[model samples]
Target: MLSTAGRHIISGEHGLFRDQVRKFLAKEALPHLDRWEADGIVDRSFWLACGGAGLLCPSVPEALGGPGLDFSFNAIVAEELAYIGCNAGITLQSDIVCGYIEAFGSEAMQQAWLPSMLSGETITAIAMTEPGTGSDLKAMGTTVRREGDDYVISGAKTYITNGQNADIVIVVAATASEQGRKGLSLILVEATRPGFARGRNLDKIGQHAADTSELFFDEVRVPVSNRLGEEGKGFPCLMAQLPQERLSIAISAQASAQRAFDEALAFTKGRRTFGQPVFDFQNSRFVLAGLASRLQVGWAHLDWAIARHVAGELTAAEASAAKLFHTELLWECCDKALQLHGGAGYMNEYPIARLWRDARVTRIYGGTSEIMLEIIGRSL
Candidate 1:
């Protein structure tokens, strides 16, 4: 655990909540993580357990059967999950999908979905990335057209999180082709709909436990009421949620980096080389010193961002910058820590190997590091 003074933004209750989360994860998630990774999907039972513990969808209000907490609670779960290297797509559900539905979905939609979601009886995925689209939302090829009282959605989305297990998918498709970004709309499609299909789970280099797959909609139809917000407001709705989504990614990256460093420190101390503990070497100590300094700065900045986020003052640009910096820092720390473990780190038997593998994808998702710089530069 981080030995520094606790985060200023996390209250005593939040700490207690964090402890509750750790205990729940220890009992429910850690034991099955390797099997999930091997299977390329987390079991449905685990989601149910999280729901039973009230660990899913922390920010949804009591009316929706949620704990009625805040984003800090979501961040706590993400941090703990990352520290233990458990990637089960819960953060995507809690931090990203729940926010979109709670903030924009119609009353009937909310009532229909939120309760089961909070109970972990329902799994959700947001379909944004497509075959030919990356970083540019305007390049999307999916289309939704009205036919009487129903809207037919047709397109395929790749790199979708929770694709295999999702009971519902929030699909982003063009409602009007001529309006560019303004034409996009968020349409809720049940996975059991007539033409909806899930492709094979793609083999990934990291986060193997999270089921990432390709989803297809071929004339899949839903009632007009299933549309989120207004017909052409999907772009704005997506933009509003980007800050929290990126912040969630940043929080996970920072925690994972801390875990990698801790693993390296422990390994070095216990390891012997040339009649001395590896940590006794000046080189090892200096490398760890540098990492420690960086982690200290990272924790302080993370707290500042979390505070601003809770106050509704965090900007998309600021969130982008945080994602950029923290994910890069994660890669740097994991790489160096793996090096500190020498040959042992390269072996899958060591936790450092998994840490190193998992650290690479944070820079790519939640807006790539390159996209983050562009967003920040545009703001300046």
Candidate 2:
């Protein structure tokens, strides 16, 4: 009964895992999202539940205590989460942060961290952006001075996702005696360390359920063994992982746009105005028609990019293009959907209002639209 596109999107073992994850989220996550949004953070219990359900770190290898799935499994989870307007933050931790560790972490580091991370006993966050640096990662001020057996880290990172509850943080810092990007190294800092402290949960215009905060490191000492990959290799490591991160953002954006369009369509069909259903109006019909066409094109592009990524053929430019186009289109869809809802869309009680607010951040995070353009332009 599924279309070819649907079948292609969810195939083989991934389809089974996708269905299971959907059911788990519908039952366990959706119900708690409102309360979590009010509290500005999802409870730790949800992370443990996701781990027990085999939803966290599904792509991790069996030797690391994971199900050994691929990135498609993570994409499915992202779609499901966005469909329900839930930014639970667990998906980011499991899908994005876990990839960084699995790909770049040393064998000993992976052995020590992967199992508990897969079990959701350990939460993780990546610190790259500083108060003065975001897309300009090379401008970071965090410094790590190497001692005989340890490295001393002192810096502050702002707008860090999952900062409040992360048990292990992948910190980007400049190694002493080196300059420019060559000095950068990735260090793992345990949250229980004395010098590591989390600032207040940031109050933002959207993504209320996802905890974004400022993190401070005051002379934190980490053993050199905690360094990820080789010294002075952090810049290249970050560059390599960015394509996947961009693709993840694109996946979320596409799903959010589709859900907004669906909600708008159902409302227009049922609501009457000027002695006829809103859908009967020529303006409403034309608007919905345009949105449907755009949605079809956007879905095709996303599916194509996803296929390339899974095949290991996707380029950085292709991933950046997907993120740029989908995020821009998502905001357009949200705004138009809100317009179609008239006064009801402006009310906080409506999901469209929330969707509209949430859509604004997609363009800003995971590398802004402008930064995406710069990356694309350099490829030409």
The number of the candidate with the highest TM-score is: 1
Model 2: per-residue Cα lDDT over 94-143, one tens digit each: 66788888898878888888888877788889998899988876677999
Q: Clashes in model 2: which pairs?
A: none
- Could you give me the TM-score of model 2 versus the true structure? 0.96
lDDT digits (tens) for residues 1-380 of candidate 1: 64436668878898788889999999998899889989999999999999999889999988876788888889898999899999999999999999999999988999999999998999999999999997888878999999999999999999999999999999999999788789999999999999999999999998899999999999999999999999999999999999999999999999999999999999999999999999999999999999989998999999899889988999999999999999999999999999999999999999989999988989998899999999999999
Which portions of model 2 miss their true places by more than 4 Å? 1-7, 176-178
TM-score per prediction, in order, is 0.98, 0.96
What candidate 1 gets wrong by more than 4 Å, as runs, is 2-4
